[model samples]
Target: MFDGPSSRREFMKAAVAVGGASALSACMSRAEEPIPKGTDDPSSLPERQHAWNDVLVHDDAGNVEGPRHQLLLYVNLDHDGPPTEDDRRVLESALTTLDRAYERSHEGLVYSIAYSPAYFDRFDESLPDDLDLPEPRSLAPFEDPEFDRQDALLHLGSTRADALLEAEEALTGDRDTANTVTMESPLTDVLAVDSRRTGFVGAGMPAERQDVAGIPDSKPVPEQSPLFMGFKAGFAQNQATEDYVTLQDGPFAGGTTKHVANIRQRLDDWYVEQDFEDRVAEMFSPRHAAEGLVDGVGDNLGDSSGLTPDIIESIEEQAKQYGRVGHAQKAARANRDEEGNVRVLRRHFESTDDDVASLHFPSLQTGISVFEEVREAMNGTDLTSNPAIRQRVNNGILEYIFVRRRGNFLVPPRRLRSFPTPTGE
Candidate 1:
């Protein structure tokens, strides 16, 4: 099934989407070089599991580039109620095997394990009042989304498709060895895999896989665009530092809260009806389109999205003037604090899972409330006061995207990652 008339990149993307032992074998056979081995001492690694930016590669413009391929494994505990200490040890051993099997970088593997609110509910004690994790719910009035209540979410990412597949197989006990390292324990020993979702990001990746649903038949996705929307994102200045998002004072200090959402895109109208200028106007701002500030895929903008405080404050005026407001422009309103520090770290990627164009959006912040505030800002419902902008139409990209699922998790620090209790016992 992996064989066809497709580019090497496309072939790898398909292999990841259709993951299994056969897919791993096919990916390994096509690998051009040996996968890098990881460290013997996992203790030296950073305490924060989300610390991937330092080791990840950056573009010529200095923006951090995400892994080429990524997967999210939502799993449930094998048994009921609270897990035993033996369960923690077994899970930790499985994760340690991965650390020993692959280097902690994009070329090897960058991953994290987070527990959901439901996972902590099994305990008698409640999470500290300071922790802002809450049950997942629909954030906008126009959408109804399913909430993911899985016990845990295991995120695995790598530049090499073979590495990503191998790591996953090893964890699920499908393979005893990962990158030639014998697995002492597999995650499946204590957890049952519930759902698996896959995605990718980077230049040429979106264009290569645009033949799926949601995208138009014209293949209007730019060759250099990292996303199907035909633009670059995750600007350095626009993102919060890992330290900023880490829990500063708690038993789970050095950890963070994560909110993951899956949004389906229907872009037939986005590409067919809107021209480049109109897209720029809606994606950035009307002023950006007027000033000709953004270039192809926005690589020329460097470390920032070119959104000024004035532009963010003028969204109502822009909507009144141009009859449209930009997606980034609206989100920027609540993405910053009084000190002007970005409040959330967005690590979203494009997907062709189930032969449909979608996005796996994972956002990290000090608390889940921060993410909700940002999403509310992105909803652009406040701007709907104007007759020109309704709830979905002309209100950012809401018209082209639909929120299908939402989930909130607490990404405990490395030490507390394995079935952590509410009070971080």
Candidate 2:
């Protein structure tokens, strides 16, 4: 966001201050690197209890870009090699790219997050944007604006010790080596930062609910959303190749077509899966109308009937909450560079799962309709036990149809994949 950094170290420090790293370099993209806390070891999965946040980084800038995090996610293509210097270089490059995206002139800085595995090595092997990109640039890893507000310069270089510690944490996830280090917030006692310090932050706070002026008329702001852009580009450009990605021996100097192709193929598949969520996000917030739900919150309530507008507004408000707080920390990590590449290197996420939660379809429509009906049933009445309407709505839906949590509607299908077709059919 500020003038291009003069030095790598300086840029690294500044990038953290903004919204972490870009999706390109040794940073995370708009995708959050999954942070499964409560365990010192990242590889082991514990029963759900501790919080899980997807905090990832990406490098948006292409490989030609001199300043890169160079994240080498693998120790050996074969499961036995230890992490090589090349691995560190690739990771560092990825971090730098993620920071750059976070430091954009527009979009200020925000965080993006998704469900990533506990281990970095197991990150989905997709380009940050999901494209078979020639070489990815870095963008911030976060996807939500709220988390971006709280996160700051990762300063991986300065916190050399901490980065190493995180690496150690990554290596073993062992409780015996649970010691860690992290930066204190700038908002801390260092110097109290009021709204004034945060230019344009509260300019629309009180009236902010009603003023989604910056919000696009397009439903979920995915295309317009920086998070969407970074991911789309990453996914779209990434091409998948055989296990050993090899391109024809070209004259691209040091360019091994093989590695590029292998990673690209996987990235392409990963990006497609990631887009599933983005498309859904857009469906619910198709226009500024949902965006205006926040605005509606600040507006004067006229009745208690809980009519269409009110209920819709409530839904929008709740959806916005998901973007704002529910996944703040995770989104912030997604906005960083380190987190972005992690997605590129890793490839084991629920995005490709067959669980009930993965069953997204027309049932969402039923859910939404049911939700509205519930609101209508509650209109001027104590709907605490309105089982008739509740059951009516439930019966209205097809079991195969997918609905959102607590929502009584069917989800819209964005593509054929939404159907329960068998693999390789």
- How large is the C-alpha RMSD of every model relative to the true structure? 1.4, 22.2
Runs in model 1 lying further than 4 Å from the true structure: 1-6
Error of 1 at 342 (Å): 0.8
lDDT of 1 by residue, 1-425 (tens): 44554656667877899999987897898898999999999688999999999989898778899998999999999989899999999998999999999999999999999999999998889999989999999999989999999999999999999999999999999999999999988999999999999999999999999999999999999999999999999999999999899999989999999999999999998999998888898898898998999999999999999999999998888898999999999999999999999999999999999899999999999999999999999999989899999999888889999999999999999988888889888
How well is each residue in 93-154 modelled by candidate 2, as lDDT tens digits? 33222332232111212211111111112333332221121211111121111111111111
> Which window of ten consecutive residues has the lowest lDDT sum in model 2?
256-265
Count of clashing pairs, candidate 1: 0
Ten residues in sequence with the least summed lDDT for candidate 1:
1-10
Task: Write down the TM-score for model 1.
Answer: 0.98
- Against the reference, the lDDT scores of all candidates come to 0.93, 0.21
Candidate 2, residue 194: Cα displacement in angstroms equals 42
Model 1 pairs whose backbones collide: none
Query: Each model's TM-score?
Result: 0.98, 0.19
